[model samples]
Target: MARWQPKLGLVQETLLLTLHARALDAKLPSPILGDTLSAELAGAIDYDFGRLKVKPSLVATTALRARKLDDVVRAFVAVHPECVVLDLGCGLDPRMFRCDPPPNVGWYDIDFPEVVKLRSEHLPSRSHLIGADLTESGLLDDIPGDRPAVIIAEGLLPFMPGDSFRRMTRELAGHFPSGELALNGYTRFAAWAMKYHPTIKALGIKAAQGFDDPREPESWGAGLELVEEQFLTRAPEVALFPQPLRALTRLTARSTGLSRQGARILRYRF
Candidate 1:
């Protein structure tokens, strides 16, 4: 079988970097994510994984965020066993596989048509797959609104421009009668720094959208209320980090202001 040489947008290309990061994390002796599927998918893709320059810090944070998001979804599913899930801007993460929702739950992985096509080629069909541009107004029409949704936007927000992210949130909130939104929050400074990140730079991303205050999204008329702000720097998983990286994370964890610029998972109930 021929390897998949994906043709994706500049923003979509970032998925490859995250996918490679998870793949690398899986290779570790005591992997954080242990997403072996990512490792297998990375091997099947026809791309230069070396160019990603995925660092240990990147691997740690990426896996940690995914783990945190998965935890939220699992908890949500436990309560709302019949809930629907919207994995917006899902890329090729295969998070549905990691979450493993029961048969009654509806899991929809939303992404660009090409990215969805790529995922279909590699992963099995376990849930609903909606392949389209996220900006489409009626994209969620086929998704029933009666059931609660567990929306996970893992590595999504930054790529959305200006009010697009906010707009998307509003749409989702209105689309689903009730649900929770979980994502890796980025402060304005962190979003700006993302452009200079080697992996982001190589992917040619310019600027990204972010909020200094996690509660700011509540005012977007999305009906979303801040439930929790999990700072990964202070998370117990930091113990898994190697010497200097673990030490650095501990130092940053000392200050909430500093930790906000690091890895953060924001949970909002709508």
Candidate 2:
């Protein structure tokens, strides 16, 4: 095995696939993710965004889903202007640039220290970057406790074990008096499939925790209540999906059972 150290920036890690989606959006008639920054970041990093080889269909799917997730976070913050928004395990995503919350909103982008060090080297200085491990770092203490909170966990849960996921949730709920959490829910099949997914397998990434039911988080603690469920297949965003696949995604989204098997974005409030 090659013993090369994995050198990657925070945005670089996320751009692995999302950058391809951004390029697709630029060529499409209608783009789901209107993130110009992602493209620019990919350029700044001199990354071969095109070679990601995310099929056009899958690229569109990811873009559309990302757009929807962006909307969810924006809406939650809008309602709670005093909210502290934390992007857990935030790789190299320029969400802060995309969302651009008001001056009073406290936004945090948390990730491994190595990733943050790379981020500091390439990305502009942002007040939100917290370099620490989500699993064990006592970083959340740095966040002010006086405000309401909103947590964004996109593409994060699958990387963590069930116990770690549960424990983190418990701590987060305890830290913030009241808040909302939005995350992409993975199914057991999705978790198993991740072990074989080409790019993921290449990175030696494995999925650890997945739930068959959207409401499964309720089992973890009484502090959370299921508020909304978003199945990508049914969302109007599917209209942006690449030609033939749009119909298929729409059909799958309409089926409650099938939707559960596919990627899901769920919300909970505490």
Flag regions of model 1 displaced more than 4 Å: none
**Prediction-by-prediction clash tally:** 0, 3
lDDT of 2 by residue, 1-270 (tens): 112233674333543665556655755667778677666655555555444456766677667666777787799888988789998877767777778888888888888788776666656766478888677747777899778888888777877765787788888888888988888888988878867766565555555568787777888974889998888888777777776888888778768888877767889998
Q: Model 2 RMSD to the real structure?
A: 4.0
- The model with the greatest lDDT is 1
- 110-197 per-residue lDDT for model 1 (tens digits): 9988888878887877878888787667788789899999899988888887788888889989988899999999999999999899
- Candidate 2: residue 110 Cα off by (Å): 0.6
Displacement of residue 64 (Cα, Å) in model 1 is 0.4
Q: Mind sharing the TM-score for model 1?
A: 0.98
lDDT of 1 at 110: 94
Candidate 2 segments exceeding 4 Å error: 1-6, 9-15, 47-52
Cα displacement (Å) at residue 76, model 2: 1.8
Each prediction's whole-model lDDT (CA): 0.90, 0.74
